[model samples]
Target chain A: MTVRVLLADDEHLIRGALAALLALEDDLVVVAEAATGPEALAMARAHRPDVAVLDLQMPGADGVTVATSIRDELPSCRTMIVTSHGRPGHLKRALAAGVRGFLPKTVSAQRLAELIRTVHAGNRYVDPELAAEAIAAGDSPLTAREAEVLECAADGAPVAEIARRTSLSPGTVRNYLSSAAAKLGAENRHTAVRLARSKGWV
Target chain B: MTVRVLLADDEHLIRGALAALLALEDDLVVVAEAATGPEALAMARAHRPDVAVLDLQMPGADGVTVATSIRDELPSCRTMIVTSHGRPGHLKRALAAGVRGFLPKTVSAQRLAELIRTVHAGNRYVDPELAAEAIAAGDSPLTAREAEVLECAADGAPVAEIARRTSLSPGTVRNYLSSAAAKLGAENRHTAVRLARSKGWV
Candidate 1:
C-alpha cells in the first residue's frame, strides 16, 4: 500500500531534501510540493494526498490555517506540522486546528518518516518534549474571538477595521483588545499583539 | 564573459527556478547555491563569484550579515539582496551593508537576470517602486545604538542583558529604549519594537 504525501515549505532546500529522503521509503510517494500556504491548499485539494507535511510559517499562510483548510476540505487527509519553532503557542494552535502530527525541523529523517507513517495510519504524533513544555505553558489565555482580534491587530489594523473584518461591533472589538491586553499583562494594544504573537496565541 | 553567480535562498523551488532561468542566458552561470546565510558566505568565500544573490531572511545568518561578510572577505564580489520584504528599513540596512542591488522577489525572471548582469558589471540597481517608497519614508529616526537596543528588547530580553550584549551600561540601555519608544510614538518597549519593525527601522 502506497501513501501519497504533499510536502509544503517556503524553504526550497529543506523541501527538496525531505522529499528525497522520504522517497527512500518504498511505500511513501511524494505526489505534490508547494511553497506557500495557498499553494499548499491548492495542491492538497488537487492531489488528495494521504498525508500533508507543512512548515509552520510561509508567505501566504501559516501551518494552522493550511491544516484547518485541509481538514475542512479533505477530512481523510492527515496533516502534520514540521517547524523550527517549537513554541507552545504554535503547538497549541496546530492541535486546535486538528493537526495530527507536530514535529520539529530538528527531528531526524528516520523519525520524520516514522511519524509520517504514524500520521497516515489515522493516529496522532507529537514530540514528547514539546508536549511537556506545552503542558507546562498551560492553555492559551485568549478566547477564539480574542485571539482573532489580536491577530488582526498584529497586522496594525484599526479598531473599526478589525471589527468589520471579524464581524463584530467596534465596542466588542475594543473589549476583546482590552481583555487580551489585561490577560497578557500588556500595557497597550501593540504590546498585546506582540505578546500574543510571541506566545503563539495569535 | 560568463558572469559567475552565487544564489542563496532558503526556499528550494525559487532558488532552483532562478538558477535555471539565469542559466538560460548565454553569459550567466550559477556557480553555487546555498540555503542558509552561513553556507552562502562560505560558498561565496570559496567560489568568489562575480555576484551573489541572497534572500534577506535566512537561517544561520541574515542577508545583511552575509552581505557584510562577503563584502569583507571578497571585496571584488558584488552582492544583491533579493527579498519579499520591501520595507524601507531593510533597504537602508542592505545599502549600509554595501549591497549593490535591492530587488523584490516579485521581480520577473527576465528582470532579475538583467539586474544580475547590471550588478555584476559594477552598477547599482534598486527596484524603482521600492526606491520611491524608501525615499518617501525619509531617514530612520533612531540612532545605531537605539536601533540595536530596540532590536534586543524585541527578543524580550532584560535591560541588563541588552546592556551587556551591546556593551552599554544598564542605564544607557534603558535610556535608548525609552528614546526609541518615544521616537516611534510607542508607550513601552514591546510597542516600540513592533512599531520599529513595521517601519523597517530596526
Candidate 2:
C-alpha cells in the first residue's frame, strides 16, 4: 500500500526537493506540501495523509503544534518531526506532543524514506544517536528562569539588560547568570551560553 | 575481540550510568572515562579505544576538540559525537572533525550499544531524523554581526546595553535586532530569540 505523506517546511527549495525525492519512491506519495505551520495543518486536515513530515520551526504553530493537532484530529495520520535541531528539549517536547518519529534534517534521502516507512508501519522511529544523547543529559539542568536568562544571553545581552527585561534587579540577573554558570559549570557567561546553546537549553 | 570505548561527559551520574550500561554489553569494554574535554583527549590519546563517545559540551575544549585530538593522535579510534543537542552546526562540525558517528544522548542502552558496534565495524552513523532537520534548516540564518548582537540579546540586555557591549551604535544594534526579527520573521525580539534558538543559529 502506498503511504500518503505530507511535507511541511519553510524553505521552498527544500520543500520542492523533498517532494521530488519522495516521488521517486513507489511506496510513498507526497500528497500535500506546505511552507508554514498553518498551511501544513490545513493541508494535513484536508489530505489526511498517512504521515506528516514537519519542520519544527515553521511560521504560525510549528511542527509540534501541528503534530498535536493531527494527533487530536486525525489519529490515523502519524506525525514525524523533522528539524535542524536535535535539542533535548525539542525532542522531549515533541515526544510529549505525541510525535511518533523524530528525524533531523541532515539524514540522507534514503534514510528519510526508511524512517517514514518505519513510522508509517506503526513502529516508533527515533534517531538512535539522539536518544543516547538525551539519556546521557538526563533531566534538563535548566530552570525556566535559567532558560529565560540563557535565551537572553544567547544574543549576547549583558546582565543589567537581562535583569531589566526579565523584571529582576541587576544583582538578580548576575545571580541567575552565576547560578547558570555553576549549574553548567561554565567558567564564564560566554561559555555558559555556548554550552547551553549546544544542549538546546537556551 | 572486545570493542574498547572511551567515554567523556561532565555529569558524574551520567558518566557512571553510561559506564554501567556499556558494561552490560558483552563485547564492549569501557577502557577509560573523562569528565571534561581535556581529560577526554588525554585519556583517548593514552588508551586508544576502538570508539570514543565524546560529549559536545564540556568544561574545557568541548567534544569537537576531543574528537579532533583523537583523529590526529589515534586515527584508529573512531570518534562518535554524543551530545544532548542535535544542533545542525554541531553535527556539521563533528563530521568535519572526522567523527564517524553523531548521536544524541536520548537513545536507549541497546541502541547505544548498536551504534557503537556499527561505528566500530567501519560503518558511519548519524541520526536520520537529525540529518533531515539540519537539511531543512539549510544553514545558519543569522549573519556574524547579527549573531553577535543576538548573543548580547540572550542575556536579556537592553538595546543600549547590547549596543555598548557589542561595540555597535545603539541604532545599529536596533537595526540588527529588527533585521533578525525580519529574518526569523518574528514579530518581536522575544520571538526572534526563540526562533533563532530553535534553529540553533545562536
* TM-score of every model versus the real structure: 0.63, 0.50
For all candidates in order, the CA lDDT equals 0.86, 0.82
After TM-score superposition, what is the CA distance of residue A112 in candidate 2 from its true location, in Å?
A: 2.0
Lowest summed lDDT window (length 10), candidate 1 chain B: B11-20
Instruction: State candidate 2's TM-score.
Output: 0.50
Q: Which tens-of-lDDT digit does each residue in B37-126 have in candidate 1? A: 999999998899999999998999999899999999899999999877678888988999999999876566777789999998889999
Candidate 2, residues B46-135, lDDT tens digits: the string is 888899988888888888888988899898999998776678777777888999898766565668889999999999999888888888
Considering the true interface contacts (CA pairs under 8 Å between chains A and B), give the fraction that model 1 also has: 0.00
- Looking at candidate 2 chain A, the ten consecutive residues that score lowest on lDDT are A11-20
* Candidate 2 lDDT for residue B98: 96
Q: Would candidate 1 be rated incorrect, acceptable, medium or high by CAPRI criteria?
A: incorrect
Structural similarity of chain A in candidate 1, as TM-score: 0.81
Chain B of model 2: TM-score? 0.86
